[model samples]
Target: MLILKIFVFVTSAIYACIAKNIILIVADDLDVVLDGMTPLSSTRKYIGEQGVTFKNAFAAVPICCPNRGSILTGRYQHNHKIFNNSLEGGCYSQTWRAGYEKNTFATILKNRMNYNTFYAGKYLNQISITISWHQY
Candidate 1:
């Protein structure tokens, strides 16, 4: 039993050491086929070359706010309830914060994997409203 416990602890430690790091970059109005990645050489070198690059991901919605909601929550616009860019459409609204924001990928990473998640870009259309890091 002691040997089995030691083996388990060693295996868990090794797995934690080699755990993959995840970085998600979402750019609006940039198409890869139109030389969008040309100016981001450092990003290409560090993140693209060193990590997995997804080649075939499509937005669940055509509009920006709904699409961003889908990306954050890993849900369809119907599920996330952000249909457009206005607060009435659920963009940064109290409804979104109370109901959907807690279920985002950032929350999952921070809560489940113990990842130190960071967000450094535009989120929704009306993100000028006060928002704290812990909100999402």
Candidate 2:
């Protein structure tokens, strides 16, 4: 089972690199039990069965905003400086509008790699509301 899982993960990564398109889904603060239940059942079935599962993956920052910042900028919260989910200072608006969005992996993919990126669901918590995702 472990070997099969590794094979699947490696294969999916190779295919993604070859295709130059990647879709990443991050569910914040959800219970692990959801993997065995309804709604996400199909996602588990398809993606798990076909793609890869990083069962032991770790988050850079456990909180929603900072972690999402890590994902967007590929930098840790210290560098991105979005310490928490607060809409106030040192948070989403300040961090993003301060120009962290320009050099993200997503922008590189969209501009250089010719990949169409789509971000769905909650973004940096409340700061998501203030910015236009289209510009990213």
Candidate 3:
């Protein structure tokens, strides 16, 4: 009876329609000002009233590559080991090793949770966000 119930639950979950798919959107160079110096007053109101605000959000590091990598990987920069910008002009990537797999959220989420992931930003760290995914 227990085994049957477990099987039923698992099967139901597998076939259950996704009510609302979760979308984690992180925008780099967004100049997110949750405090004061924000020019996006209208956006602030929208995000303030309708959004799930996180006041104590702190990046692992100030640097983009390492921090974005860390956010994706769920691992610290030390763990993934991307320390500095490989690029020079701060426009595009200049890394010697650029085959994805730096330290990012999409890679970890896709690899672990098997969820459909999408990234749109400056992707010149060590990974690209062009990944294919489906529930079928």
Candidate 4:
């Protein structure tokens, strides 16, 4: 039993040490094809060069709030139910709070993967006091 416990502890510690860090940067109206990244040379040098870059990624929703919802929940606009940047469109609406907010990528990383997560910048157009750091 002591040997098993020691093995478990050692394995857990090793796994924790090897856990990769995650960084998600969402830039609005920035297009790679249009030389949008040229101004962020320092960011490109420090983060882009050292990290994996998705050169061919495209947003399925093409609009701010709906696209953000899709990014967070890893769902299509139809599945996430966010049609636009309005409360009526389900951007930070009660339905989104109740159904989709709890299961976002940030929440999953923080809860299931045991990662310390941080979020900054505008989330959604209709987002107000209902936002929490833990839920971002």
What is the Cα-based lDDT of residue 101 in candidate 4?
85
State each model's CA lDDT, in order: 0.78, 0.71, 0.56, 0.81
State the weakest 10-residue window (summed lDDT) of model 4: 127-136
Model 1 spans with C-alpha error above 4 angstroms: 1-15, 32-57, 128-136
Can you write out model 1's per-residue Cα lDDT over 1-136, one digit (the tens) per residue?
A: 9999999889868877988887677777656888888888987898789976778877799898899889888899889889889999888888889878887887777776656666776888777332324333
lDDT tens readout by residue for model 3, 37-119: 26657766887668866657778978877776566557676765667666542212433234335324555556655556655
Query: All candidates: CA RMSD in angstroms?
Result: 4.8, 11.1, 5.9, 3.5
Model 4: lDDT of residue 106: 78
What is candidate 1's TM-score against the reference?
A: 0.69
Ranking by lDDT: 4, 1, 2, 3
Local error of candidate 3 at 99, Å?
Answer: 8.0
Among residues 3 or more apart in sequence or in different chains, the pairs in candidate 3 whose N, CA or C atoms overlap within 3 Å are 69-103, 72-104, 72-105, 73-104, 100-127
| Model 2 quality (TM-score) | 0.68
Error in Å for residue 55 of model 3: 2.8
Residue 70 CA displacement from its true place in model 1, Å:
0.5
Clash counts for all predictions: 0, 0, 5, 0
Q: Write the candidate numbers in order of decreasing TM-score.
A: 4, 1, 2, 3
